[model samples]
Target: MAMNFFDQFDIPYILGTPLVIPALLFPVLMCLTTNRFLKNRHMTIQSWLLNKTTKQLLEPINTIGHKWASMFLTLFLMLILLNTLGLLPYTFTPTTQLSMNMAFAIPAWLMTILVGLRNQPTSSLGHLLPEGTPTPLIPMLVLIETVSLLIRPIALGVRLTANLTAGHLLMQLISTAVLTIMSSMTTTAMMALITLMLLTGLEMAVALIQAYVFVLLLTLYLQENI
Candidate 1:
């Protein structure tokens, strides 16, 4: 039963092929791409919000980092949409998959590291060690720093996966309890149902927050590189 519950987290497949790609791209398709000067109010408002968010995120970043603003902004929108939409009934969340999250994390993290290495090799390498360090601790500190650096993408993937997975599991457990006790104990079932509703709302907030945190961290990584 527990394994089956967790099996929901697995990527959906159709005829033995993964169906996650289309589900992942669903939000992008929902975005309007008309070239007309005039647009609907919803799309216009969304565009304005997107502009504002991009400005806010890029403001603290360096001018060189501004070049990547569009990419990051798109990523933010993608993540927010995915996270929120996953809560809808019968929808699959690609972000729930570690492989999917790792795919996003590794390349972005790699890009920042590569950019840092290509543009500012000395300064980038300097990040691994601090100044005025004692000679005895140099090797140990460098080793620890290297390990920390290597763990970042893994951290990113795991953080996202763990949060979403926990929320989903909690929701499932509460829902199962509600269903099981619905016939025998009306009072207990009602209370569990109320808690489930509250948790559902909380999960929605977590969804939005996790998305923002993911993008924010990515931008910070970019800031370090640029």
Candidate 2:
């Protein structure tokens, strides 16, 4: 029963090995391989989306960090694909797993910190204590800020994992209830079914928004450093 309820978040295995690599690669492999003068509707829509999203995401970023734009865009694409694809029947949502989210969060967070330290050591370290901090309160404030700084990656991973997991669990519970009561309470089952449909739509939007938020937060962190 436990397995049945949470199995959607589990990493699937093909024979012996986990299937995460292939799942992650799927979005990357789906992108256009070559540029052509002529484009189909699918290609045209894809290009338009790419351009619009890139502009929107990069507008807040500074010129120095523009080089990382491709990396950020690729990560966002992977996240959105994984999230939305998992909504389909018989699929797993990787972001629902804390470990996977942490894996992405830690490295990205660490990279931004490293950039700040390398580019402007004094300014980066200066963030530990705000200007005009009272003498006695300085230590306490610094301690608080340090802890907060260290918690950023944890917050990022937990935010993604918690949001996705909560949505999936709610959907599962609603569907289960709908199934359980369908034979006896037809009207109630219909209501539950409608709610489930609405919730699914909301989850789709959450998936996209979370992907954007993840990349946007990373960009914000980079902006602080650059």
Candidate 3:
């Protein structure tokens, strides 16, 4: 008997061995690059999409910030691919892991903060204290803002994990219910299966959208810093 539906989201192992890293790397294998480009249709499409997305992301940034665009674009592509891959049956979703998401969020967020501090120290520190604050409230406001600033990475990690976890949980429940009742109730099972299919489509969209949201927020943070 199954202990819980949550187990489905557990990091899968093979033959008593943990597969945390391998599972994460598996999705990346899907988009193998072609050194010579035009020989492969998928490579061509991926390159085109990446270039277009990169342009859109970096278009608003100053010339100096343009250098970071490639890194961000690559991150976005990896994230979207992983998110979409997690929607597949019997696969683990790495973004659902808080630690993994934090690993990504913290360093990136910290780097941005460092960039801001390095480039425009005054403007960066000013973020911790809003403009036009009254004397009495200044100390309290600074503390609050400082706390918020530090929590940005936590927010980023939790946002990705929670969204992916919730979607996976919902899908698992619906699919399990559909399976459990299928033998006894054909019509009900069929309806539930149809709903499950539609819900899956939504989840796929969520995966892509969440990736975009993650990258977009990071870009905004970079904008402030740079």
- Clash count of each predicted structure: 0, 0, 0
Per-residue lDDT, model 3, residue 78, is 79
List TM-score per model, in order.
0.93, 0.93, 0.92
| Predicted structure with the largest lDDT when compared to the true one | 2
lDDT of 2 at 62: 91
Q: Order of candidates by lDDT, top first?
A: 2, 1, 3
Residue clash pairs of candidate 2: none
Query: Per-residue lDDT tens digits of candidate 1, residues 1-226?
Result: 8888887787778888787877876876776554447689976997899889988888768998899988888788888887777788877878898988898899989998999999999989998889999999999999999999999999999999899989998998999999999999989999999999999999999998888888788888878777
lDDT of candidate model 1 versus the reference: 0.86
Q: Summarize candidate 2's per-residue lDDT along 144-199 as a digit string, tens digits.
A: 99999999999999999999998999899999999999999999999999999999
State the RMSD for candidate 2: 1.8
Candidate 2 is scored at a TM of 0.93
- lDDT per residue, candidate 3, 160-183, as tens digits? 999998888888888889999999
Clash pairs of candidate 3? none
- What Cα-based lDDT does every candidate model obtain? 0.86, 0.90, 0.85
Residue 80, candidate 3: alpha-carbon lDDT: 85
How many clashing pairs does model 2 include? 0
